[model samples]
Target: MSLLNEDATIPFISRYRKEITGNLDEVQIGEIVKFKELFEALEKRKISILKTLEEQNVLTTELSQKIHNSQDFISLEDLYLPFKKKRKTKAETARLQGLEPLAKMIMSQNVNNLEQTASKYTSKEVATIDDAMEGARFIIAEWINERTDIRNNIRRELERFATISSKIIKSKIDEEKAQKFKDYFDWNEALKNIPSHRLLAILRAENEGFIRVKIEIDSERILQRIENRIIKSQNNCSAQIEFAIQDAYKRLLFPSLSNEALSIAKEKADEDAINVFTKNLKQLLLGSPLGEKRVLAIDPGFKSGCKLVCLNEQGDLLHNENIYPHQPQNQTNEAIKKIGSLVDAYKIDAIAIGNGTASRETEELVKKIFFKDKVDVFVVSEAGASIYSASKIARDEFPNYDVTVRGSVSIGRRLQDPLAELVKIDAKSIGVGQYQHDVDQTKLKKSLDTTVESCVNTVGVNINTASESLLSYVSGIGPKLAENIVNYRNEKGSFTSRKEIKKVPRLGGKAFEQAAGFLRIKNGKNPLDNSAVHPESYVLVDKIAKDLKINIADLIGNKDILQKINLQHYVSETIGLPTLQDIVKELEKPGLDPREKAKVFSFDANIKTIADLKTGQLLPGIVNNITNFGCFVDIGIKESGLIHISNLSDTFVKDVNAIVNLQQQIIVKVLEVDVVRKRIQLALVK
Candidate 1:
């Protein structure tokens, strides 16, 4: 808590302060952060409630202690229910009519002649004994609803035995737009057992005005339990109390508890959906990179022609043009000659083609052309390329270029390094989430931002060449500071050492401490600047080098010498064995990228569309999107095929991610194909 309160980031605390944290990993530390915030919020609410109670002159010793001891929101609210100010209700109206004394008499259960007792309360407002008894019952019902034990019992019942049901609005049942949610129009399921995606679908159906959703439990059983707890004897007073219990169950208790149950379910569903999204986003961000390759990229189309751009090793756009190799303008010979000349002229090491519209045709054309050098070919997912092209960031980066040229450059850069280019666009628009639009927007943004930050810090950033978007995700460096760093770099040329990072305007000592270790400088003045070692630990490294009679440069990457050192000898109060071990490991492989190099993937050449697919045919595919129920695989066609969880393996599969990941290449056997609907069902070939 103290570490977090001091503005230390999760990645920094987990990586640098292992001794103080007992070596907790990032996930564990993140949980601590979440609960710390929750606890602080709870404490603030408690203080407000205590102050309100004092002002109301109802702060009894027992009630104050109970409120202080309450750990969760539900329990705290239950304790405060009776004292909470409410709008004009039946009980309040009855109290205003001077019927609370009769209500109290009935609750005591000692009055044998309840009707005669009720008659004494009759007046202009309460004309008859029956009217008086009815008013008294309303007050009794309110009292019963306020009992903490009664509300808790009902909450437990709802949690264990609730059913969620949805029905279509009859007026819109036959509308064409409502057909998509028809399956949920008459749905009933156990709320506790429903999957997140299914629950979100039902909720969305209700939101769209196509259905009305309700929650239900066994009302009679719950009422009986409440009666057993409240009733003491069988008499006229017991019967009156029974009437109150029935009213409370119907009008007050069940309604409130059922809503709470539904809200809890919805919160859990949101959490599950967000977890899936963050996992997928992390995988996509950490996907393999084609590092520092000069490449020719193409965005394929038929009528608009394929937009082509050649990028240098630093991902700068060297040139861009158009080539119509397919369809109406079948200038195949001219296109091939132009591509060959561009490859030789730009010294292109690889070719990247966007996997959208006419991609296969372009791939075939490119493969047939003879090149001056050996070049690998790749098909990149252009899911959010168009979004990036029209974005303000893209416009700022290339003010003179058009969207098409910007899009082609984005595709090329995505191949070079996905994390750097993809950060410029919103994570939700990247097409790697399940029901992203339906979940809580604030929570989705926070989780995705955390995932992006973790990924960026885990693979360290290059200080000199990283974009503002990439640098902003580095620990303790935000958008404003990132812009300052870039402006400083542009004005004074590339950074020569890590110490120069502190010179950026408004970047103070604390921010530098948190961000310096994660920012690497290649071939810097100090060799450790290119490694993961923090500047605070440089003196220790210098001492180790002096003891070994070698310079800092000789100590780096010398596995034999590094292995011979006793890690305990360097351990201090602040730097323990864990930090020393990490320092040695980083020194052994300074600036080594943890991600694998990009590989070339190919689809079956004979298949182009849904019509070409046949049941029982084996084909190669790439897993594109994943959900709780199944994953969708792209098999070189417009419509990706679904591999349901049941067919993921020979045994029962609980998690779809355990079997397949995003962008994973696999061979699948077609189980069924509905060409009319463009739906293909596949099974893992295993």
Candidate 2:
């Protein structure tokens, strides 16, 4: 591949640089790239090995083939290991002790009786039968160990049928820190079916040293089969050597083969689990929008009075009230007046009720009030609301209001800007993502942070409503300066223009350049704030509009003139042809929310649990999760239904994810519903 083209996008290469990737799809091309890198590295390694072997006069054609055919890094290294210089061992010593002829004679099985075979080698060096037997056993062990074919066959067979075994040692022998491994002791399970979570659990346990574990494939049948194959003809005289060879295969070969089997199994598990997590993350970041809602927010409570905050169409909180809706029976009159006035005064469009303790009761009250008024309302998921409420961002924004009022604000803001509000809280606290804690924390944090960044950048921020927490998530800024910007704004009053952001502490030209376009300021000095076109691109926009001889207002959404512009003319090396083309397309449809369809899905009102489902009953559901086992659809939040791997197919389905995806809208028929455990099994209806 050309180095220049290598750095380009897969989409670009697949469409334009066909010669480099051979007209392959994105996935196939990615695999080819990875394989090519690995092959090149392998070739370099082979050259070094060949040079050394040639110097030693040990390089042979057969040996070269074996080395080249090694499938992985481990197997390649293993192939080179025997020829590697090492310390003296029992087998090496046996050869030096003049017992080679006797060992080879017994391996060929040229004698009948054990004692007779032993006696035939009765020289001074192999003086006794015991000494002769010892040398013979060591050679046989080495023979079995070196047979790569036997090793590969046994490893494959073991993986098909082996059980992993472990035993916990006594407490006194192991430290207190090692006690966690005790549970894994004496455990036995098939390697193929074990999950990644469980595999890692066992690995952690093994690291603690309270357990001795082995992957034990019942190789009795295989050992007997090998004996029959290798021994060829059986004789009473050769029986002793046969027994010794079988013992060597069992003691020396089985464990090593089992280790290889486990490695392969773990690799497969990691691939599957990684794919599952990545899909889940992508789906979560793609949750539907409620758009810009004019919300009447209710922070549900009982003892502590419920805080009511009303926001405008742009999500700026316009009114705040504290009501004892669920408690303080005497305060009922005051509560009614405050709530009624706010709803009527601002023409509060929707009641964004928090799903908290008094949420259902509050919903009931809103339903009664809005029923006559023709208002819409939705019970929003209030996950991590408390975290947001107590946060510094919340306090900074709504200093006059208490935590309850801040919570109410968050609920309203979340409805208006899910991506913006969600970024403020930790993703783990949001209850999405994976076994986040168990995985490499730094890696997980990096990935999750990227997901949030991508989502935020895709849906540009409203600079006026954005808090420091929200602004930090914008392309260039971070938490510290985001806070500084908010502080500066608080002191300086509402930012009238995007250009004024440079006045904030440490907000230099570079930061402003990266962040300017994404931080939209509606009704700001520049009309481009309402769109995605940056201030740096303001000249470009004016130039285009000038050439077209139309006003900037008329220039937008007019596809005919926009398409005629040569993007290559404006493109610099820093901004390539690809980037210029994308910018032009984006400018055509500025401030577009790059998300999946913003469709609201409501489950059956009566069906709160899986027990309410019936087999063959078709239900319109949202795909919550997709795994190798099957797709899981959420009829309601209480539980999701599983469509097994078998049911994921009208034809053969190798990967269930290929058939369906996370957060996708699909209809599924309930196949089995278990009420007690709250498991719902569903199959795609179509």
Candidate 3:
């Protein structure tokens, strides 16, 4: 299969295709695609189970099937009760140990002579009828428990019947930081509804000995069914055996099974949260393309002279200089001249002022100049610009320039293209919230990696322009190979074609197979490279061209001719209907960016102060955080707003993330604006 058309999921394509992916490489994309498939398949299996049981006559086919098909495992178990089997219990053991006949004799008619039924199964071991009947009772109980169907049913039933309990098991776990997990000491939410972040937090709290949690479920009803299935009581098992079966359930089985349910539910929540975060991150990373913009970036500072860098159409810094523009000594004249000259010389249209110290002042100066010139001013978040400045990537990319200069250029590129520049910085360093640094680092990395991968695949990459930092986030490629490709590019000079990328050190045929589709080569020797068609599947194009009696170009975009051919014949171990269908879609729109359009927004000059805000005012805001509590929105003023997690959506939102994401632009109404304390309570009305 061609790499572009290779239906070999993300994992298969990435692991095998090293050479083709380049910097916006392929490692993470495969995991996401594969996981998504796995998740879908699990949902299908869940549905299949319900359908099978419904057809078997044990359940009401229509209404019961609906409950079974739902993803809620607890609800499904409720309907599975009748078909469940009775397994071996103490009662079953009593029956099996030559006492079942005696038990049945007790269940039959008026038992005036109860001694008679017990005598038949008597031996030295069961010398008395009471002992015989007791042995029979044990056998019957054992039989109930051994039934697999009954076990499955009971497991399902107990999950819903369970109650989650939390206790402040320890007071001094973190006496210094006791407040953090204090709210969790008495948690009792249902397992099915608990949010992933909260669940992980509670689990962490429990692990640290700050709290103890236990799930309490109804075992009596579950045991009763088991008893009836095995003993068939017209009046069965001297009630004493019934008590023993109940004891077995409570003492032996229920605790472990209930815990299993909790574990499974917790897993499901984590998986779901990870998936959602990954999706949001992908969208944020690969968001709209600002196009090949020529920009001048300014890193605003006080003591340090404001760093300035001008990037060309391709994002390469063409000019770099420094100017002390603010604080104790603001070189207003010198700064203006330098900036004005560069804008005029490079025909620069925009100036990206970093949102740091002296930023608004810098913007003010730029705005004054722009009032008389062609350049416009914009304020960009310098979140991870400093981090990137100190990293090895910045050193290698701008070897001759100072650290601040590189940061300024990165700030400019970020404004022009977020995903591309943000890729250069560690996701962790892009400070969007509090506690981001202290949270579980490993968990954060996994989440960030997933997000980067999803974004890279969604936006795809321009093979020619993407840097190694950006490329490393691709599904299959990692930091090492991303460096190798850059090294190869430096040694080999500019690549004029995608095929040449395969020759880079460490990149082989397998890697190329996975990454080739996503990376594009504009105006390359082979038109297919500019599109997603892999080199391996060039023959398929050739065959199609030959069969159509036309050249590859003519066969590519012709819908009428391409639609007539049957795709099933192409299916194989290497290729399937999914792949074939993808090829056809690519033929229609080659090298499409899957990201959404980035809406342009500028801070309103009149609304520069929090005091200017009015009640019930509608404004555009950027999401600065997504926390368990709420979203913090930066609404152009110096102070950010609190869209208390409750205000993120109208529904009862468990996860604040589901309603708003970091860096998302949302339209909000100022519900209660305060200037005294500098607080603005906002709501996403729509």
Candidate 4:
């Protein structure tokens, strides 16, 4: 924790400061970072609570000790409840009427003549002794409600036995729109066992005013427990104490603890949902890339015609065309001739078709055309391509082109490299997550940012050609520094060496040191600069090359020569075997892509729509989205099929990731089809 406080990023601490952190990995270090922030927040809250109590002149030695000793916010809040100021509650009004002393006397349980004692307090304000005792009972009920031990025990009960139940708004139940949430209309489940997706669905329905939801516990059991704690004697005051206990349990404690339990459950659900979203986002971002290739991409549409753009190997848009391949303008012959000409003229390597409106028709059209060269056709997911099309990045890149052409360009680049192209769009708009919008937006963004950073750093970036969006995710470079790096490259020409990066504006020594290793400069002057070997470690590589009696260039990618060198000779106080091993590994595969090359996936030719799906029909499918429940697979149809976790394999499967991954092509057998819902259920072919 102390090490993390010194501006040390997770990757730096996990990779470089292993000795200080006992060799904790990135995930463990990230957890420590989160908890450290949590502790600081708790400390701030403690200070605020202590100051508030002191200002109210109610601070006591025992109370101060308990507050200082609290380990969680709930316990601390339970202790502070008695002193918290607020709008006039029933108990506060009674106290203002001067019934607190009488309440204290009633709680003492030593008063035999309770009515006679209450008579002494009777006045114009009291009206009658019964009224006075009633006010005392209200104060007593509040006192019972405020006891920390009592509140804590009730909280435990709520946690152990709470049930979340929802009911449709009576008038909305008959509405046609309410059918979408039919499953949750009469839902009742144990709060502890409810899955994150279902919880979020329920919340969304409640938010839309279709249903009312509440957490419930056994009220009688709670009353009995409170009575056992507060009712001490069988005297005249005992009956009043019992009444107060029941009043507190029913009116205050039960409601408060139930809400608290629901809060905890909601928080847990949010975390679970966020984790799912983060994992899905990571997989989608790191999906296979068809390395730099000339791509003719198409954004398929019916009335608007298919928006077409030809891109060079570097994803530079060279030409744009609109072809009416389907529908009202069924100029198939003209579209086919034009496509063949474009393929021949541009020397196209691959065809990327956006999996959107009229995608199947466009794909059929493209495959039917006789190209001069054999071209591999890819159906790319254009989930957020439209969002990126009208974005500022797209506008800056292609000022003369409209959104249709820009969208086609995005689809083309996404096929060329997913990580680089997808970074320009918001993660939430990618449509690869479950209940994303329902989760905590702040937490979701933080998690997605961390995931993007991890993936970007894992697969090093090309500093010379990377966009500001891609460069911004590098280790230490942010939006401003990324823009400056791009501007500096434009003005100074392509960087000949990694050291030239120091000339970029506001890129100080610290920023360069953190970011330089993850930013690759291919074909740079220094061989080690193109590799992950940090500038600080260049001396170490030079020493190895000197020992071999050869130039540094010969030392890189020479596994046989590298093997003969002794690692122990290079060990020092600062550099250890872990880093030395990493250097050797980098030398072997310097500047290599960590992702697999993209492959063409085709669905069953017979199946073009959900209506074509039949039970027991085997078909090829690509895993598109994964969740805790299952994965959604695109089987070349208008409706994607769902492979539930149970149906993923013949044996019991605990995690869906263990069985399948994003964009993995596999064969599956259809199990069921719902034509009305446009749903297909499938099982993985053994």
Candidate 5:
């Protein structure tokens, strides 16, 4: 908490301050940060409520004490419900007629001859005994609604017994767009037992005007429960109080508590959806990288031709053109000759083809050609490549190029380093989420941003070669500081050491302390600059080297020597064995990427389209998108197949992630295929 209060980032605190944090991981620290902010917001709301109560002259000693002791928002709001300002209401109108005394008489159950007592309160507003009685009942109903115990009781009942039901709107039932939600047209389920995906689907149907959703419970039972608590005796006054209780239950309590219950359910659903998205996004961002390979990338198309770009080892665009290797232009010979010449001319290391229109055909063409040197062929997912191409970052990076050329460059770079190129595009646009648009956008963005930051910081960045977009995700450096770092590098040349990061504008001591370990400077003056070791511990490293009779360069990557050093000997009050152990691990392989090397995967050659697929046939596929229900796999065709949770294993499956991950290669047996609808069902084959 203290570290977070000092503006320290979660990655920095969890990684560098292990002694202070007792070795808490990033997820635990993030939970602490979330609750800390929530606590502060609750405190702020309490202050606002107190000031409002004081201004209204309703801050009694007991009420003030209750407000101060309230632990949750629902309880605090219940305490303030009676005093909350309101527009014209039935109770207010009855109060204007001076009927409060009669209402209190009925509530106490002490009134005899209630008709005569009601008649005594009659006036122009209440012209008869019946009118007065009705007005008094309205005031009594409002009082019942405001009671904390009554409202809480209703909430408890709703939580335990509520059922959610949806029905199609008769007028819109035949509409073409409404057919997609027909499954939910007449659905009923226990609210607590409904899955998040199903609930979200029903809510979406309601939002789209195709269905009317309702939350319901046993109203008669609830009414009896309320009457049991409120009625003291059977009399005329009890009958009048009973009328008020029914009015309150129908008009005020049920509606409020039902909506609150639905809101809580929706919030839980959103959290579930966002967690799945967060995990997929993290996996996609941390996907294996080909590691700075010189590449020739192609964005395949049929009529418009395949857009081709050659990127150097640094991913700088050296050349771009067009190749038509598909139908409508029988220029396969020309395309083949052009590709061969370019590969030889640039000494290409790999060929990355975007897995989009005419991808399989282009891969076959490229595979048939004879090149001078060995080159691996990769089909990269172009999920957000078009989005990134049209973005301002792409425009800034390649101002003179068109969207097609820029997209081809993005595909190639994604093959080389997915994290660096992906951070430049929006996480939502990458297409890993389920119902992303329906979830809370603000929370989704925050979670995705945090996942990107954690992945980037975990892998560590090369300060000299990293773009501003990638640099922005480094622990403490945001967009402005990242821009400043880039501008400083452009003006002064590549950074020679990690210490030079401090010279960038607006980068203070704290920022440097948090960011330095995650930003590597390769071949720097000090060997530790390229590792995950902070500069504050440089003196300690120097001392260790002096004791070993070796230089810093000799000590680094010397596993035999590093293992012999007693980490306990270096532990101090501020630094413990955890920190020392991490240092030794980093020393084993300084500046090593934690991600594995990207491998070339090939889909079955016989499968080209949905028409080619046969039931019970096994084929290779990649898991593309995941939801709470199942995962979608791209099986070398336009329609990705669904591997439902049940089909994922013969045993009971609890989590989809436990079965497969994003971009994971697996063999799946075809269970069913609907060519007209382009839906394919697959089962994971062990």
Candidate 6:
């Protein structure tokens, strides 16, 4: 609590102050932070409630005690419902007409003749005994509806046994666009057991004007339950109480409780969808990087010639051009000759092709052309490449180039280093999430931002070449500081050491302390600056080096020397075994990237589109998107196939990720094909 109160970041406290947090991981620490925020909100709500009650002059001893002891919002609201100011209702009209005494007489259930008692309160407003009794029942219904015990009991019943039903609007059933939701035209399910994806789909259908949804339960059972609680005696007024009980359940209780149930269900569905999105986003961000290499990337198209760019090992754009090798302008010979000459001239090591229109044809064309070196060709997802190309970041990076040229460059850079390149684009635009638009946008952004931050800090950043978007995710560096660092680098050259960052305008000691450890400068004067070791721990590293009788450079990456050093000898009051062990590990592999090296993937050449697919035919595919039901795999075609959770493995699969991951290449057997709708179903090949 104190650590969070002091505005300590999760990574800092988890890594440096292990003893205080009991060695909690980032996820556990995040939970604690979330709970603390919720508690603070609850306290504020309590204060507001107390103030409102005091102003109402209804803060009696019993009411005050109950309000103070309430633990949840539902209970507190239930206690406040009777005292809450309401609009003019039938019950309020009856009360204003001097019918309360008759209503009270009926409520007591001790009156012998209800008609005789009701006649005494008769007036111009209540002209007859039947009118007086009707007014009394209206008041009684409101009274029964506001009872805390009654509302709580009904809520429990709804939670345990509600059914959600949906039906298509007859007039819109034949609408072409509404056919996409045809599966949900007529559906009913237990609200408690509906999966998140199904619920979200149903809600989307409802929102699109295709279906009307309703929540219901056993009406007779609920009415009996309410009647048992409200009626106490079998007298003349008991019948009037029964009428009131029915009115309460039908007009008041059912509608309100059903709405509450649906709202809760929607919230749960949003949470589940957001969790899946975060997991998939994390996996895609941490996908393998094809380390620094001279490469050529192409954005394939038919009418517009393929946009191509050549990038150096440092991902700097060296050259770009347009090639017409497919359809309309098939200058095959000229294209091949130009590609070969450029590869030879630039010493290219690999080729990257965007998996869009004409991708396979371009790959075939590139493979046929021979080069001096063995150039590996890779097909990468172009989900957000276009978005980045048209963004301000792209303009800043390549002010002289057009959007097409910038986009081709982005595709190539992603192949070389995915985390570094993809961070420049928004996570939502990456197209790996499910129902992202339907869920809470603020919450989705928050989760995605955290995931990106964790990935960036885990892999560490290069101080000299990182873009502002990537650098902004560092522990303490925000947009302004990131821009400053980039500006300083551009004006004065590369950062030579960690302390040089402090010299940038608006960058103070605190920002440097939080961000320095995650920013690495290769071949710098201070070797620790290139590693995860903090500047605060440089004195300890110097001590270890001095004890070993060698230069600091010699101590780094020397496993033999690192293995012999006792971490216990370096422990101090603030530095414990965890920090010392981390330091030793960092020294062994300074600035080691956690992502794997990217590999080349290929699809079956004979199959180019959905029409070419056949049952029992084996084909290679890459997982493109994931959801609760299963994953969508791109099989080198315009239409991706669905690998339902039931078919994700030969064995029963409970979790989809336990078997496959985003961007993972695997062979699948075609099970069914619906060419009309451009859909394919596949089974995992064992």
**Candidate 3: 10-residue stretch with minimal lDDT:** 15-24
- The most accurate candidate by TM-score is 5
lDDT (Cα) of model 2? 0.69
**What does candidate 3's lDDT look like per residue over 516-601, in tens digits?**
76677777777777676666767776776787788877776788888886777665666555556767777767776665544555
Clashing pairs in model 5?
Answer: none
Report the lDDT tens digits of candidate 1 across residue range 491-544.
998999988998999999999999999999998899999998999899999999
Model 1 weakest 10-residue run by lDDT:
677-686
Q: Tens digit of lDDT per residue, candidate 2, span 1-686?
A: 66323344333344333444445655565556667777888888877777777788887899888777876766666676556655786777777777677677777776666667666666777678888777777776677666666676776778688877777767634576665555676687888778665676676666656677677765677777677666855664256556666766767677666777777776665555555665565566666666775778888778887888989887787888778867655466576677777878888767787766766566666655633365676666676888988987678677777787788888887776677777778776765433444455554565567556656666777776677767887766778878888788778877778889899899888677667767777676666667766676677778878977988877777788889988777765344565456556766786777765344444555564456677778887777566556666766545767788788778988876688766667888887877765677788875
Better of 2 and 5 by lDDT: 5
Give per-residue CA lDDT, model 5, range 1-686, as digits (tens). Answer: 88888999999999999999999999999899889988888889899999999999999999999989998899999999999998999999999999999999999999879988888999987899999999999999999999899888888888888999999999999998898898998999989888888998999989999999999999999899889998989999999999999999899889889999999999899999999999999989989999988999999999999999999999999999998878899699999999999999898999999999999999989999998778999999999999999999999999999999999999999999999999999999999978888899998999999999999999999999999999999999999999999999999999999889999999999999999999999888999999999898888889889989999999999999999998888999988999999988998899899998888989988899899999999999999999999999998888899999999998999999988989998999999999876789999995
lDDT of 6 by residue, 1-686 (tens): 89877666776666666868778888899889878887787677777877888998888888888888887777878888887788998899999999888888898999987788889888998899989999999999999889888888888888899999999999999999888899889999999999988899999999999999999899898788887876889988999999988988889978887898888898899988988888898899899998889999999998899998999998999999999988999989999998999889999898999999999999889989988889999998899998999999999899999999999999999899888899999999999868889988888898888888888888889989898999999888989999999999989999999989899999888678778889999988898999999998999999999999999999999999899998888877888888888999999999999888898888898998788999999999999998888999999999999999999876888888888899999999999999998889998774
Estimated TM-score for each candidate: 0.97, 0.65, 0.64, 0.97, 0.98, 0.96
Compute the lDDT of residue 485 as modeled in candidate 2. 80
What would the C-alpha RMSD of candidate 5 be, to one decimal place?
1.2
Per-residue lDDT, model 1, residue 393, is 90
Q: Which segments of model 5 are wrong by more than 4 Å?
A: none
TM match of model 3 to true structure: 0.64
- What are the per-model numbers of colliding residue pairs? 0, 3, 61, 0, 0, 0
Candidates 1 and 3 compared by TM-score, better number:
1
Stretches of candidate 6 exceeding 4 Å from the true structure: 98-101, 120-131
Shift of residue 57 alpha carbon in model 4, Å: 3.1
Error of 2 at 395 (Å): 7.8
Model 1 steric clash pairs:
none
